[model samples]
Target: MALTFTEEQEELRTTLRRFLADKAPSAAVRRAMDSDEGHDPLLWRQMADQLGLHGLALPEEYGGFGGGPVELGIVLEETGRVLLPSPYFATVALAGQALAASNDEAVKARWLPAIADGSTTATLALAEASGSWRLEDIETSVGNGTVSGTKMFVVDGHTADLILVVARTDTGTGLFAVDGDAPGVTRTRLETLDPTRRLARVDLDGAPARRVGPDGDASPYLRTVLDLVAVALAAEQVGGAQACLDAAVAYAKVRVQFGRPIGSFQAIKHKCADLLVQIEGARSAAYHATAVAAEGSSELPVSAALAAACCADAFTHAAKENIQIHGGIGYTWEHDAHLYLKRAKSSEQLFGGPATHRARLADLVGI
Candidate 1:
């Protein structure tokens, strides 16, 4: 599988980046983040209908563009740079994958078409209060056509039309689909470090749920979707890191100090250089993971884990360094630096944190 983007891929990035810059500017992000819905449905439609981004990776039979994971990675990177406040990631990376990978064709038929058409949105409700990525941490039970318990860290949970819940069943862990507004389903918006991505606490007390997969171990598909999500997030983190680095360099070049640009100083140059090197490394890891995912390579687990851990740290570091380089103004809420920092912090924990992925990596590599 090729690690580099093709000409068509580059064109996709250019198009997406331009679109996001015009429509999803920082002001738009601020407005969306402050709104009750945490995202603009209109913008979501524009992205899906106009850009055809929502179906980039699904099969053409499902109304998709029949692209692959690399295309999705490009879309994610561009969206991350602008902090797009949409449920595209949750819908595509989480629920879409769960349905696509599950054993039940009925569930796929019921969901994939609408998802591919961007008519409905969905997310995977996996991690619980334990804050663990392990399937065992899922306390929700799926038995007798009901789901019981709570799921925390559900991305875009409040707005998802459908929720693919991971729950324990009589046979083993299984996947279940529950309507967002179904009876006994409660979603409480949680105040998060990053309001750009709305998170909610989902409570299911005997909520009506239909089985979406076989009544057996769903670990393989679960892991597959989670890995893809990790790869997508890693791409986003790399984008944020690159943005922070660019912002720091631009500021350092213009902000005069001692009658010259502050960037002339050895200290400032060293900081920027360090960030550039790390950001590039993180980019390589994320890109390689994306390419691997696109090809369905056997090395996906290790690549995804590495991308998750490396990109998380690199993005966080780049954001912190950007703030440090910017001095006092970066700390203010008005500045965009803090927004990227908050996103970095929030993303580090989604799906699994760097440390969690590090452990997973060790096991996968047999180290």
Candidate 2:
């Protein structure tokens, strides 16, 4: 597939890129990351209430734009480009996708409206303390109207208004919705490596559990949610890699070495050339996956896995090369290169490492 964006999509990307450049510059992102709430409420409100980005990909019944994954992919890419320190990915890409996969209309009617309007934020808690992404690795149990055990690394778990808990049921894993402030539920913020992305530990002591899908065999729904999330994340990685490459090239043009621009050197040229190749390849794969997702194709799993591994490695490579290209200044805290590097490293481990996804792809394509 060509994986080209429509004119409307290009316009959307331009608008969001301009908006984030103005509202979420490196200084703003740093401030938000260090703030008490760990994000800018006002900025988030503007992105949601003003731009209507919170509902961009949701159904019209839930007060959204009724768009598909392509729109969501655009927003996520812009957010990644600027390192916007909001719960956007966790809320929209993860939780929103999960809720949309549920078979229960009553549950959707209750939750989707609030989420669509930006009146509420939510996250899906799937990874347990073991930190495995596999569905079978989940150990937190839910049965007889109760949930037990704990989940870790829940994005925005501390501040979200709603929580979607994936629990071990009698038949298999089940998706449950729990009110954030419900009794016997605890959320503690973790001191994560990347402060821009919030991580929380959620402990549920017989907390209320309501199955969002059918009572038995919810793995298909979970897989669907994960595939959607992977496509979004891959796009984000491409954006970040693009930013890193831009920064490196810009620096190479200005920084003089031996009375000439460093970019003229064969070594620097080779590094930049290598980065460009990786980023372009990753971008192609990511955009293809996003396009496939918009079509709701059955090939999503293989595409998602390919995009995930390709984008993850590309972003990490670009970040590291960006720092190396900058020489000394990139090593300091004052520079923004490290921020992209940190986020790139964190994102690599978010769903699972690149190696993990490649392994999954091996089975997904029967290689």
Candidate 3:
């Protein structure tokens, strides 16, 4: 609640920041985004092997450190700052969280260890052609141990080793595990504004599948998983917003206009000051949600919605103002400013956008 980090947390942030600076610099990020795999496999392995990042938030019984949302948020925020162009978010934040939150021990035992060790990549396929993130809007259905439907905007869907498909069943909404390469599964990479993060369309035509969670209504469990993920995404947005503010201030200090540094101008100073205030507010919102998630508090839903709305808006604003501060140079293909803006805009819409989150927040708070 105080938004203060422990000493260890600060160390973790420092280590990850240094690592990203060395391994995931601008050129490296560009290379990975342009490559077919969309990320460096070697770096991915190193993250698991050296840093144990993939397992930081997983249960120790599943070959992890048994950390929670707070630890995962730290990792995500660091990765987001660099726009690392990796499937870490899809593999760990999305699928890993879903499996961990499920009611099936067998499912967790079968999949979580692989995820912790970074041996497998996976993603949750929730949104579809209808362009909705709500469980009630899901049209994918399961029958006779098979799933059939088209899932769009699946993060890392084309390359993930496993696909956790949210499908409709006679009982209620359920989670189905379908092997990425299984028969009757078709995956197509989609062209997106944010090339740093890849998305895909997955078509399942009677794909063999096994139910991962309860046979009865699993909507409640799925909703909790979604809330946790929203908090994690908010952490990432905070990092991106902070980066934009830093970049803008740094550029304003150096770039000259009217025989003086632009940062010395009152308008530029006001913009920087406003961005700092917004970023700090967003950071507090994200940190509070992370704490609530770690505590498994009943307030997670409200906190998550609040974080999602605040952080998304803050990140987008920071990115836009960052571009504005840099003037014409920021608009160029060679500049990294545009990439940050693209990531901000793309992530803002990833889980229903700021307006959707605000509406959810209002409904949850009975306002």
Which stretches of model 3 miss by more than 4 angstroms?
1-3
Write the residue-wise lDDT of candidate 3 on 59-105 in tens digits. Answer: 99999899889989999999989888999999999999999888689
> How accurate locally is residue 352 in candidate 1, as Cα lDDT from 0 to 100?
79
Candidate 1, position 11, lDDT = 98
User: Arrange candidates by TM-score, highest first: which order?
Assistant: 3, 2, 1
Evaluated against the true structure, the overall lDDT of model 1 is 0.89
Whole-model Cα lDDT of every candidate shown, in order: 0.89, 0.89, 0.93
Task: Determine which window of 10 residues in candidate 2 has minimal summed lDDT.
Answer: 144-153
Clashes of 1: 0
Name the candidate, 1 or 3, with the larger TM-score value.
Answer: 3
Off by over 4 Å in 1: none
Candidate 2 lDDT, 265-337, residue by residue in tens: 9999999999999999998899889888888889999999999999999999999999999999999999999
Alpha-carbon RMSD to native, per candidate: 1.1, 1.1, 0.9
